[model samples]
Target: MTYALVRPARLDLNSYARATGLHPEAVRRLVALGLLEPVRDARGELCFSPAQVAVAARIQRLHHGLSINYAAIGLVIDLLDRIEELEADLRRLSERH
Candidate 1:
C-alpha cells in the first residue's frame, strides 16, 4: 500500500483576518492578548492554523453575545478550555471501567 502525506493548512495574518472577517490589526491585537496562538515562519511573520478561525469566531461570539471585554475573554477561554480537557479526561477514565 502506498502512503499519502497530508499537510495541515496554514494562513498568514491577513488571510486569517479575511477568513475570520476581522481586520488584520484586530488579529494582531488578539495575538498580543494571547487569545490566538500563531506560529512564525522563516520571515518571522505570524501564521495561523485553520483551527484558529474557529477560535476567532468563538472569541467574537463571547465578546458580542456576552458583552465580555477582551481582557476577561482570556480568562473565559482558559476556563472553557480547561473544562473541555477535564471532560475529555473523564471520558477516558470512564471508558476504562
Candidate 2:
C-alpha cells in the first residue's frame, strides 16, 4: 500500500496578502471568523499560507460580487468547510470500499 502526503510551506500574513492582492486585515478578519487558519509563532504573531491567501481572495470576491454580509459570509464559510470535510471523509471511505 502507498500513502499520500500533502505539505505546503508556511508564509507570513503580509507576504500571503501581498501575493494575492488582499489586505492583511481582511485575512485577519477571516481568521477570526474561522474561514481561514493562520498559525502563530512564539510571539503569537499570525502567519498565513499562500493557499490561505487564495482562499481569502476568493472570499473577498464572493462578498464583493455577491454582496455577502459578514453574518452571511460566516454562515456560508462554515457550511462550505463542513462540505469539504465531509467530501474528504467520503473519499477516504470510498478508497477502502
Off by over 4 Å in 1: 1-8, 94-97
**For model 1, how does the per-residue alpha-carbon lDDT over 1-97 read when each residue is reduced to its tens digit?**
9675986679999999999999999999999999999999889999999999999999999999999999899999999999999999999999999
Off by over 4 Å in 2: 1-8, 81-97
Candidate 1 positional error at 81, Å: 1.5
Give candidate 1's error at residue 62 in angstroms: 0.5
Top candidate (TM-score) = 1
Clashes of each: 0, 0
- Model 2: weakest 10-residue lDDT segment is 2-11
For model 1, the local distance difference test gives 0.95
lDDT of 2 by residue, 47-91 (tens): 776677667776887788989975588788778889999999999
TM-score of 2: 0.64
